[model samples]
Target: MTNYELNMKYYFAPLEGITSYTYRNVHHELFPGLDAYFAPFIQPKQTHVLETREKKDIDPVNNSGITLVPQIMANTADNFLWAAQELAARGYDTVNLNLGCPRATIVTRHKGSGMLADLDTLERFLDDIYNGVANNGPKISLKTRIGKDDANCAQKLISLYNKYPLPELIIHPRTQKDMYTGTPRWDVLEDCLRISKHAICLNGNIFSPADHQELTARFPTEKYPNIKAMMLGRGLIADPVLHREITQNRPVTQSELKRYHDTLFKAWDALNYGTSTLLHRTSELWFYLGCMFKDADKYVHKIRKAKNIPTYQAAVEQLFEHCEPGGYFSAP
Candidate 1:
């Protein structure tokens, strides 16, 4: 296989409710260069076919230009296999299992971020996947947090990972306890690269090329040299041209930002979603979009509290009117 950097894709990580086809389509239409996108974790083992909403999100008809890696949330071996089959049934060649969900509702079930806390269980989970339950596009990838709550958890987890033959290991080097609180532990990633069996794709706080450079400089992937492939989530929302910056090595222009904001607004308008719905979608995005402005916090407040579309549109128009977006990566 090609080394990580050579094979690296400027990918968009699946954020539940945020990175769906509507959002993905809108993003691609406005700002291009996303290599592949991960669909938000679909509880693969769920009792039925893709529900109305998910069915649409994963629909091949909608995602023509972009490569998509369907992501599944599995709590057990059965869940993993079931989800994989479902994706295959839908004609996907590969799938990603979320080992990084930190939400309490998800983790409490030994799914998501909680799943990483137990090595033995995780081992079994993988064994089941490799055992051939997933006949259609059995290829599986893992997206993970360092541990449930501590640094040691990642140490033990990495050892376990070294034994498996995963296609790729996407690591966000922070514990579940952090809940995105502090900086990612790069040292843990360094240790992981030394022992991991699969290709290592770095994730966590890759908002800008600077962040990407920092990881490459510190970790220095021995086999790959520079593992450029990374998963961008909040970073993309913070700055949609992130892929452009990473690949083209150029800053986004004012026209680019306005185009993105306008496209998103138009998509929402056509969907005929109520003002509250539009506000809800825009607000989730502004969590990072706020960073692009002069008075970010104030702009965020204006977008968030707007009760209706006329009000919300006026706010959005105002925010983008003066300040231009700039970031390697930014925060909520």
Candidate 2:
């Protein structure tokens, strides 16, 4: 590993409906390089109560030994504070604010990247939350996009973030308009690295060691000391050993991948969320995992199309039997 890779921290970005506590625990046990795991965003309600599943996800009992940072997605300061305090009481010291989610359902609700559309409202919300949680709650970090529509908005966004004493500012260098398509705006990220007061973590389009090498080559740690971490969501999901690959120069073997998959499947299946839910959940994983195998199109299609648990199992078996790892895995 290069000095840049060694000095950098690796965080697993939260993927809602995918990186649940069960998944986190399993991944933490199998993969050793991740510094922390951020839970999927919890959208607090007016009543200020966490759902049973949400409670379980953040529960220390379920996430022992892992450094889990719970993320809150709220339009209002009160809602965000309530969730932060709740986490603080549960022994969490750091909470991530989710301003990066670009899903239409979340954006339409004036949350996530939608909050970026109106800087005034966004600033007010930030001000209130920062003040409300200043003395008693967990410290707030922010995971955000550059802007709602224009990449250039990063200038004002960085200025706004500078006003606050954030522990870290995780930037996915894409506008809401850009979604996950096209290339990530590396120039905008460079600007953040140059000017942001808080530590900056890069996210987006990082899938392999080559990608990380290119990133570090561009923003060498010796030059960009404030670039504290890299957050991986889709890439990590596609290859659980990505961090190991980058940091330890280790490649994932087929047996290791198979064991990890089986272990994860058994854990989720034990939840007994019913066959349909199990199939749905496992299939969601395959959408990324399938990309790691050679000639996986037919098997992946069968897995996705499977209506029953038996069929799903059969398709997965065939995939493991016929396909080999080390295929060109790309982010989708």
TM-score of each: 0.91, 0.97
Candidate RMSDs in order:
2.7, 1.1
Give the alpha carbon lDDT tens digit for every residue of 35-147 in model 1. 78899988754564557777788888888787899888877776677767777887898888898989999999999899887788888877777776434356887888988
- After superposing candidate 2 on the true structure, give the runs of residues whose Cα lies further than 4 Å from its correct spot: none
Name the regions of candidate 1 deviating beyond 4 angstroms: 1-7, 133-136, 222-228, 327-329
Reference-based lDDT, each prediction: 0.77, 0.90
Model 1 lDDT, residue 92, Cα: 90
Candidate 1 lDDT:
0.77
- Report clashes for each candidate as comma-separated counts: 3, 0
